[model samples]
Every structure is written in C-alpha cells, then in structure tokens.
Target: MKLRSKIYLYSSVLFAVLLVIMNLAIYYIFSTLSVDNQLDRADAEAAKIAADMRRAGSEVSAPELLRAYVPIEGMLRLYAGDGSGPAPVTSAAEGELSTLKPVFYNEKHSEIIRVDGRSYAFISIPVIWVDGSVMNVQMTQSLESTMDTLGVLRLVLAGTTVFALLPLLLSSRVLSGLIMRPIVQMTATMREIKQSGKFRRLTLDETSKDELVEMGQTFNEMIALLESNYVKQEKFVSDASHELRTPLTVIESYASLLKRRGLAHPELFTESVEAIHSEAIRMKELTEQLLLLAKHHEHWNLSMKVIDLEELVRDSAKVFRNAYGREVTVKVKGEVKGYSDEAKLRQLLFIFLDNARKYSDDDIYVSLEASGQERLITVVDRGIGIPRDELPKIFDRFYRVDESRGRKQGGAGLGLSLAAEIAAAIGARLSMDSVEGAGTSVSITIAAGSGE
Candidate 1:
C-alpha cells in the first residue's frame, strides 16, 4: 500500500484495538460492582426482615408477618431445622428455584447463585419462629434489575467505542499529511531539478528543528557542493584548452616549416626545429601543471613529520644559488621546528622563490621564524613586483598579469596555483602582498594544530 494509506490503516487499527480493550475493562469492572451492590442491598433487606420476625415471636402469624415483609420481586422462605416439618413458608416470588437447595448458616450469610438459568442473590440466617423454636430463613432476589442496568451500560460503552473512532481516523489522516508533507515536497523539488537541468533545494522552516528539516538542509548543502565542483571543473577545462591551443599552434606551424624547407634551407631548418622543441617543452610543462591543479588537496597522500624550518629555508636557498647562481639570503628567528609534510613545504617555498626570482634582479631574502603557535616563513624579493590589482587573481591557474612578460619568463602562470595546492595539502596558509614599483612579500603560515 501507499505510505499514506498504510499510515492510516495501521494507526486506526491500533487506536481501535486500544479503545475496545479499555471499554471491555470498564464494562467488566462496572458489571462486577453493579452485581455486588445488588447483592448487598438484598442482604441488608434480609437482615431487617429477620430482626422483625424475632422481635414479634408468637405475637404474629407467619403468613401475616411475611405479607408485611414481602420483597419487590424476590422471595422469603422459612424452613424448620431439618426442612422435614411443615411446608416451606414463602411469600410471593418472581423467579423459580427448582435446581437449588441452599444450606443454612448460623450467622448472617449472603451469596449469589444460579437456578433455572437465572441468577439470584441468596441470603440465609437462623431466627426464632412463632412456635418458639429456632428456624432457618432464606431470602433470594433475582438479578433482573442488575442485568437491565448493565444492558443499558453495555450499549452506551459500545456506542462510545465505535463513535470514538470517527475522530481517531480523522486525526490519523491529518497526522499522515503532516508526516508526508516534506517527503512530497522533496520529490517535487527533485523533479524540478531533473527537468530544469539545474540543482534545486527544498524550502526550509528555520524554526522547526525536526529530522525532516535536517534532511532538507543536508540535501541543500550537497547540491551546493556539487554545483560548485561542476562550475570549477568546467572553468578548468575551458582554461586548459585555451592555454594548450597557443603552444600546439606554434608547434604545428614550425613542424610544417621543417617538413617543407629542412633539406634545402639549413638555417631555416635549425630555427624551425628549435621553435618546435621549445613549444613542445612548454606544452609538456603546461600539461604537468594542469594535472597537478586538477587533483584536490584532500586526495594527496601526505607524509607528515617534524621538520627544521631553518634548515629547509637554507637548503632551498642553496639549491637556487647553484641552479641560477642568484644569491639568496636566509634568516631564522626563534624556534623554527614545525610539523608538516617536508616535500610539499619545500615545493611551496620554491614556487614563491621562483616567482620572486623571475620578477626581481636583486638578492632574494628568506626568513623562517615562529610567532605565537604558528611557524611563519616569508620570502621577499626586490624584483619587478606584481601590481596591486592582480594579487587576487595570482593564485588562479593560467592567469597572468602580463602575458608577454609571463611567456618570456617561461611561466605558464601556474606556479602560484601549484603553490596554493601544495600549501592546502600541507594545511598551511599562503598569502602575498606586492606593489607595482616595490617588491613582493609572500608568507606561508603553518599553525601548530594543522599537523593533526
């Protein structure tokens, strides 16, 4: 069955069963109390009749006394000690007792009995008779009054039980609607997303802190994350194609020239081959950078360990001096020990140094120090600094402030982007500041807790 129908059916059945059981319990208790009350009244009446008979011993005839003490629809019977004497002394009665013979008791006694398929309340006591002998008096009343009253009660209870279900079933429908409302809305939102080819989220009520609202919130977050990744993926592909097209066109042109003039024009053949090789190397570098940028930082398997920031800085500077013969000055302040992935940290430092080396001709300065709970490594260079407007876009892949200068510098504009990825992978913060005429300062901050 559909969820709504199943909800309605199960809820209604549960309420109905509970209501019937409650009514049955009420009926059972009430019937017991009613029958007991009837028996008590008959017992009390029997006591009063016996007292009167004893006080009037020999002063009145049995028939006359019985006539005055006759019950409404009950009986009063007197029997001698053994019940083998004269006939039973009984007043007018309503029900027959052909199947019952009750025993007499010394003190007052009361009981319920069944005779001729009808119920009765029987009370017996010993009393002094008109003959000055002890006699046994039996009083019995039919249970017709109790049965009639109980019959009325049964009808009322059954009616209440059945009628109570009307509101219960109605409330079940309302409850089902309340429960299924969010589910239906979510389905509709999904359908809209499918048809419109765009991600959609459920409208949420902030005040309601139920699971249904939490579900909608989770769905919205997931959709937002997916949309963000999708936009980034599309932009990455578009930029990659644009960047690759230029080098590919250069290589193709040079290849065509080599194919046409290589055997005849020796100098032209050498120039063409050189051009093709240069573009081919640039293409290879661009492809490698693109692959690095494509992988998210979270997927990189980092080998985290404690590294001496001071030593790492001096080592990087020494490598730069050997490779480019550019003098790099290194300074260490306070304790420079930090927990991080050493290889990724070194790569991040090298990207900033490369950028500084390209833009500046003066000596490059590197500082390693500890401030508060973080390890700060700053790289400063006296190069042709970046303009203030281009600082924000510096970390975007393939974004260059001056494309001509950037191409001549052998920079595909992805060094800082790769630096950013490395910094993220090692849980470090990368920031940069520069002026057009002045130099640029790049800093990497590794907080103490970042290692964990």
Candidate 2:
C-alpha cells in the first residue's frame, strides 16, 4: 500500500486495539465492583434485621417483626432447620419471589444466585427466634436495577468507543498528509525539471524546522550545484569553439594558399608557413589549458609535503627567467616554510610571472618572507594593471584583461583560474593588488609546515 494508506491503517488499528482494551477494562471493573456493592448492601440489611430481632426479646410477634423489616422488593424468611420454618416473609408473594426457598445454615454467610434468568443476592445469619429457638434469617434482594444500570453503561461505553474512533481516523489522515506533502512536492518538481530540461526547487515552509524541511533544502542545494555545473559546461564549449575558430581558419586558409600559389611565390610560402606554425602552437596551448580547466576540484591529485617556500620560489624563478630571458629580481626575508604540493605551487608562480612578463618590460620582483604563522610569497611587476571593476571577474575561467593582446601573446586567460584552483587545493590564499597604470602584484599566504 501507499505510505499514506499504510500510516492510516496502522495507526487506526493501533488506536482500535488500545481503545478496546481500555473500554473492556472499565466495563469489567465496574461490573465487578457494582456486584460487590450490591452484596455488601444485602449483608448490611440482614445484619440490621438480626439486631432488631434480638432487641425485640419475644415481645413483638414474629409475623409483625418480619413484615416491618422485610426489604421493599425482596423476600425475608425464617428457617428453623430440618425443613421446618415459620414460613417466608416477603413484600411480594407473586412471580419470582414465591419460588425462593430459605435454608438454615450453621454460620453467617452470603451468596449470589440466578433464578429464571434474574440475579439475586442473599445473606444468611443465625439468630434467636422470638420463641427462644435458634433460626436463620435470609435476606434476598433482586439484582434487576444493577443489571439495568450496567446495560445503560455498556451502551454509553460502546457509543463513546465509536465516537472516539472518528477523531482518531481524522487525525491519522491529517498527520499522514502533513508527512507526505513535501515528498509529493519534490516528485512534482522533479517531473517539471525532467520535462523542461532545467532546474527546479521545492517551495519550503521556513517556519517549521523538521526533517522534511531539511530534505527540501538539500534538494534545492543539489539543484543549484547542478545548474552551476551545467552553465560552466556550456560556457566552456562555446568559448572553446570561439577560440579554435581563428586558428583553424588561419591554418585552413594558409594551406589553401600554399596549394594555389606557394610554388610560384617563395616569400608567400614562408609567410604562410610562419603564420600556420604560430597559430598551430597557440591552438595547442589553448587546448591543453582547456583540458586542465575541465578537471573538477575533488579529482585533483595533490602530493602534499613540507617544502621550503624560499627554495621553490627561487628554483621556479630561475627556470622562468632562463626560459624567457626576462630580468627577475628576487628578495628573501629570512627562511619561509609551508606544507604544499611543490610542482603545483611552481605552476601557480609561473602563471603570475608570465602575466607580468607579457605586460611589463622592466624587472619582475619576487619576494619570500615569514609573517607570523604564515609564509607569504608576492610577485610584483610594472605592468599595465587591470581595471578595479574587472578584478572580481579575472579569475573566472576564460576571462581576459586584454582580449586582443591575449590572442597575440598566446594566452588563453585560464592561468589565473587554474592558479586559484591549485592554491585552494593546497590550503592557501591567493590575492592580487593592482593600480590601473602603475603595476600588478599577486600574493599567496599559506600556513607554515604542520607536517601531517
């Protein structure tokens, strides 16, 4: 069965069982106690009659005394043992009363008896008869009134049980609905997303803090993440195509030109060859960066260890300067240490230094220092700095400061974005401060080695 139905069925059954047990207990206790009360009242009346007979001391006539003390609706009798008696004294001589027979017994006692489908309670007490002989006074009272009262009680209890079930069923249905509402909404939202090919979220009730609300919030978070990844994927494909078109067109055109006129013109052949080669190399670099950018953060495999920041920076800069033949100034403010992946940190440095080299002709300054508990590395360049407004977007993948210059310089604008990823992977902070015309400086702050 569906969850709503199951909840309703199970709860109803449980309530029914509990209600039955409770009502049965009430009925049983009431019946037992009421019967005992009837017996107690009968015994009290028998004792009172015995006392009156003793007080009479044979002065009062037996028949007159019996008539005066007989119950309003029951029989009072005197039995002298051996089947002999003064006779039964009863208020009513007709119907069930005429059938009752009093018996003489040795001790005072009481009992309940049923006669002709009617219940009766009687108590027998040994007493001196007014004539000076030992006799038994038996008081018998009908249980009709108590039985009628019990009948009425049963009716009330049955009606109450039936009435109570209405509320139980109603509350169970309402509670089931409350529990299933979120799941139903979530299912509907999923259907909409599938049909429309877009992300959708549940409308939450923020006033309630429960597991259902938590489930809705988690679903919304998952949708948000999915939408973000989808947008990134689309942007990557579009930008890749845009970047590849220029180089592909150049290569295709140069090959077509070579086929048509390269044999007749040597300089035309050299120019076409140079242009094709340059575009091909730029295309290759762009493709490589695109592959690197496509990797998710969790998939990045980092080999972490304690490495001297000063040494890594010096070695990286030495390689950078030798390859590009650029003037690089290095400064060390004592020894700097950090826990990081050395190769990725070196790549991060290269991205900043290369950007500086592209925009400036003067010396690029690299500094390493220990500041409090953190190691700080900064690279400064006298380059044309970015506009302050564009700083936030600089690290976004495929974002560029100078689009035309970037194409000519063979930079795909993915360097800073990759640098950001690497810095995050190694638990470091990367930031840049720049003036529009003066220069740009990038810094990385990392905790000192805690060898884990």
Candidate 3:
C-alpha cells in the first residue's frame, strides 16, 4: 500500500478504538447513575408509605392505607405476618405477585426482577403495628421506560460514531497526502532525471526545516558533482580517441604498403619497415600513457614513507644527467624532509625532468627550497616556453601547445596531466611560470607537516 493509505488506515483504526471505549464508558456511567436514581426514588416512596401508616396508628385498613399512599406509575402490595395472601393496592399480574414471594421470603430490601417478560424494580419495607404484628410493604416500578431511553442513547451514539468515522478517515487521508507530497515530487523528479539524462535540482520550500528539504538540497549537490564528472569523462574519451587514431592509421598504411610491394622492391622494403616500426612505437607509447591516466583517475594507492627531499631530487638529477649526457644542476636551501609516497614522487620528478629535457637544450636546474611551513621543488629550464594563453590548458590530457614538437620528442602530452594528478593525490600544489622563448619553471609546493 502507499504510505498515505497506510497512515490513514492506522490512524482511523486508532480513532475507532478510542471512540468505542468512550461510548462504552459513557453508557456504563449513565446506566449506573440512572439505576441509582431509580433505587433512591423507590426508597423515598417506601418511606412515605411507612410514615403514613405510623400516623394512622393501625386505625386504617390495609386497602385504605395502600390506596391513600399509592405512588405514581408504580405497584404496591401489602402482606400480613399471618399466613394470608398479599393485599393488592395496585393492578399487577398474578405471576408477578408470585415472583415477588421469593423476594419477600428472602428478606431482600430491593431487587430487579423480570416478570411476564417485563423488567421491574421492587423495593420491600417492613411495617410494625402497635399490636406487635408485622406487615411487609412491597413497591415496584417498571424499568421498561429507562431501558428504552438507554436504547435510544445507544443508537444515537452508534450513529454518531459511524458518521464521524467517514470524516475522520477523509481528514486523515488529506493530512497524510500533505505530509508525503514532497517525497512524491522527489520521486517524480528522479524518474525524469533518469529518463532524460539531465541534472535538475529539486525546488524546495526554504522556510520548512524538515528532513525532506535537507535531503533535496543534498541530492541537488550530488547531481551537480556527478554532472561535472560526466562532462570531464566525455572530454577525456574524445581526446583519447583522437590521439589513438593517427598512429593506428599510420601503422595500417605502412603495413599495407609493405604487404603489397615490399617483396618486389627491396629498396621500398626498408622505408616501409622503418615507418611501420616508428608508428608501432608511437602507438605503444600512447597506449601506455592512456592507461596511466586512467589508472590515476580511478584510485590512488600510495606507499607512504618519510624521505629526504634533497636526496631524492639529487638522485633523480643524477639519473637524468647520466641518461641525457647533460649537466643537471641541483640546489638545496635547507634540509627538506617530508612524508610521502616515494615511488609516486619519483614519477613526478621523472615527468618534470623529462619534459624539461625534451623541450630545452640548456642545462636543467632542480631546486628544493624550504620556507616556513612549506617546501618548494622546482624544475627550471631554458626551453621554448609555453604561451600565456596556452598555459592554462597545458595540464589537460593530451593537450600540447606545440603538437609537432611534442610528436618529435615522443611526448604523448600526458606527462603534465599525470604529474598534476599525482600532485593532487598527494595533497601538493603544482604550478608553472613560463616566458615564451626565455624559459619555463614548474614548481610543486609541499605543505610543511603534510602527508605524515
């Protein structure tokens, strides 16, 4: 069932139970009070009859006394201490008189008995005469009238309860709908988003301090982030596809040329083979770079340790100097110690140094400077520096300011992207300063007490 329906059902059931209890309680209390009042009236009537008999002082006959003391809407009977039958003062059935015999013998002061299928309240009083004889005065009042009144009350209560339930259920349903309206809207909005593949936020009532409002706000923020990530993912896929197509087309062309005419023209065979080899190498490098970019985007798995930043830079500079047969100057201003993933830091170093070597013919400078609460690691080279307008896009995947130069240097344009990702993953800031035709300087800032 829907939540609104369930709320209404449960609430109606509870209200129905309460109504039943209240009706039963009212009937019981009213019935008890009515019975008590009837008994009191019977006692008062019997007292008046006894008083009249005392005033007469045995001078009046039993029939005359009963006639004189007859009560309104009631029956009266008198019995002697002798074994004589009762004297009737008011008209009553013989069976009813017989039913009263047991009550008299039992000496009960008051009782309610059914006679001839009609209910009666009987009150018995004993009378003492001056002659030492005893007499019993019995009075009875019909309960049928009071019972009819109660029956009417019961019917009225039952009818009221039945009529009240319709409005109760309807009102409960309306209240439940009002309560669940926000959730219903949220569900519809989610369905629309799923169908259209669009990120749309929920318009909430800002004045309401309910949890549903908070949930709507949070959901809007989550969709915003997902949309941003989706846009970036689309761009990455487009760039990767464009980068892969050229090398693949070149390889396929060279392979086709070799297969068609290489055996006939031995001179053409060498050129075709070389072209195929070069293209294959390019494809291999592009594939590796794409895999690296994908891996860094997914999750960072760091093996953190403390290392001397100065020593690490010196080691990387030595490797660079040996590999390129060029001088790599290392300058340290202080003892730079940091806690970081050593392998990832080495990879970042390789990217910067390799980029410097590929672009610049001048000697490379790797510097580490420590100031208050921060350490700066910079790679400076006198290269064909990036244009100011192109610098912002340099860290974008497969973006190259000089595409031909990058191709000649075997650069897939992923080194700076990978470096930036690694720096972000390790909680460092990577920045660059370059002047076209003068030099380029790339620096990574490591906060003091970071990565520990």
TM-score of each: 0.78, 0.76, 0.63
| Candidate 1: tens digits of C-alpha lDDT, residues 1-452 | 98988998899999999999999999999999999998888888888888997787568777666656767666777666665323334434663552356465667678887766677898888887766777777777789878888999999999998799999999999988888888888889889988997888888998999987998899889889988888877887887887898889988898888788877788887788788889899889889888887787767778998887888889999998899989999888765788889888988888888888899999999998888788899999987888898899999877899999987887887888898888878889988988787899999999653442
Model 1 clashes, total count: 3
RMSD, model 2, all Cα superposed? 4.9
- At residue 190, candidate 2 shows an lDDT of 90
Best by lDDT: 2
Candidate with the greatest TM-score versus the true structure: 1
Q: Better model by lDDT, 2 or 3?
A: 2
Clashing pairs in 2: none
Query: What lDDT score goes with residue 259 in model 1?
Result: 82
Ranked by lDDT from best down, the candidates are 2, 1, 3
> Under the 3 Å rule for N, CA and C atoms, how many clashes does model 3 have?
0
Across 1-452, the per-residue lDDT of candidate 3 in tens digits comes to 98988888888899889988898899999988887787787788787877677668568776787777765555777766565533666544333444445334325388776777776778877777546666677777777778888889999889988998899888888878877877787788889989999877888889998887888888888888988999888988887887788788888888888789878878988887888788788888778777767775346678776778988899999988898897899999867887667888888988999899888999999899887777789999998998999999999888899888887887778889988888887777899999999989999887664653
Off by over 4 Å in 1: 21-71, 74-93, 103-146, 203-218, 268-274, 292-299, 384-417, 448-452
- Candidate 3 Cα outliers beyond 4 Å, as residue runs: 2-164, 175-210, 261-275, 296-301, 371-374, 384-394, 401-410, 433-439, 447-452
Candidates 2 and 3, the one with greater TM-score = 2
